[model samples]
Target: MPTDIAFYTNPMSRGQIARWMLEEVGQPYDMTILDYDGTMKAADYLAINPMGKVPAIVHKGKVVTEAAAICAYLADAFPDAGLAPPVDQRADYYRWLFFAAGPVEAAVSNKSLGLTVPEGRERSMGYGSYDQTVTTLEKAVSGGQWICGDQFTAADVYVGSQVDWGLTFGTIDSRPAFEAYAARLRERPAYKRQKELDGALIAQMQKSS
Candidate 1:
């Protein structure tokens, strides 16, 4: 039997990340778009995700929350899509993937809020500092290639999404490395196809509103 994949999402939110991961995995998923005004907070949705957040997934009777976790799960479940590395590269894969969700996210959120830690507390902070995170990411992409060296894995999908979103919203500086990395991700046919479909839907919603 094929996996029953159900995606709970709000198109305007982090749900977009899960949508992109679905596209990358090339899986047929049922989408339930939730509204913030008590729709997602409803008992049914809350049962699937106690946190009442979108971008949760139910596959084969198992529920998965968090955008990064969903992305990683889909990649592993759909190995035919080749979005994940083999067991040999699993360590690096998990490292960068969580790094994206953890440190990268922390740095970006802090920077956006104009929150800074004391100089001595840098080591205590997971991301060290916003500048350090950006510099490290720049070096990671400096070779004009994907994060996992030559191969583009699920790590790219997660981290690349952050890089692309950050650059698009002007939340992150547009360094040469970031620009090139984002360009490489944008060139993916899967990414383009998903973006085009979502863009049209967003436009229609805007027109209706």
Candidate 2:
């Protein structure tokens, strides 16, 4: 039987984020592993995502791309998963989710590539300064529960991934708040399962190459 969801990804990419969300949703899905220099950029895939990126999904014929968007979409699509805050209670959910997608992602990528914002030109960048972005992120997750209080919404899946990856790669500061938040996220069964699935795929790809 085919699932309504068709996930296209590479285990080594941001696809891991979507995979975690899928695991949390507990839905059956079919996965297609695309190679970076091959089918990922092929015409069929480019038709699905012109950006030629991994981490794209087709749910009931509708295509969704970008890791953050995928998490949010899955949460909404699978309401039974309880991965999204109620409409009236989504202020923090939307805020922090997009915060990680926008400011945190931009800050980390720019810093990794050694692209510093010129002094006083921080206003031009969406994230302002990298230090400011990191500080703001620290405050958001320091609350000790989830991104949206007691509920473990999709916002955590997206925002937490940024913190988790940042901590592992040293792209973000290793503050107690960030560390604590990631520790809690690690405790999720879905998170652990996502890692195991992707880790095995990565190992296989490496062995074959």
Q: What RMSD value applies to candidate 1? A: 1.9
Score each candidate by Cα lDDT.
Answer: 0.85, 0.95
Which structure among the candidates has the greatest lDDT? 2
User: Which tens-of-lDDT digit does each residue in 63-151 have in candidate 1?
Assistant: 99998998889888998998887888776678778888998899999989989989799999999989988887777667548767788
Total backbone clashes of model 1? 0
Instruction: Report clash pairs, candidate 1.
Output: none
Native-referenced Cα lDDT, model 2: 0.95
lDDT of 2 by residue, 20-91 (tens): 999999999999999999999999999999999989999999999999999999999999999998899999
**Candidate 1 wrong stretches, greater than 4 Å:** 1-3
TM-score of each: 0.93, 0.99
In model 2, which regions exceed 4 Å deviation? none
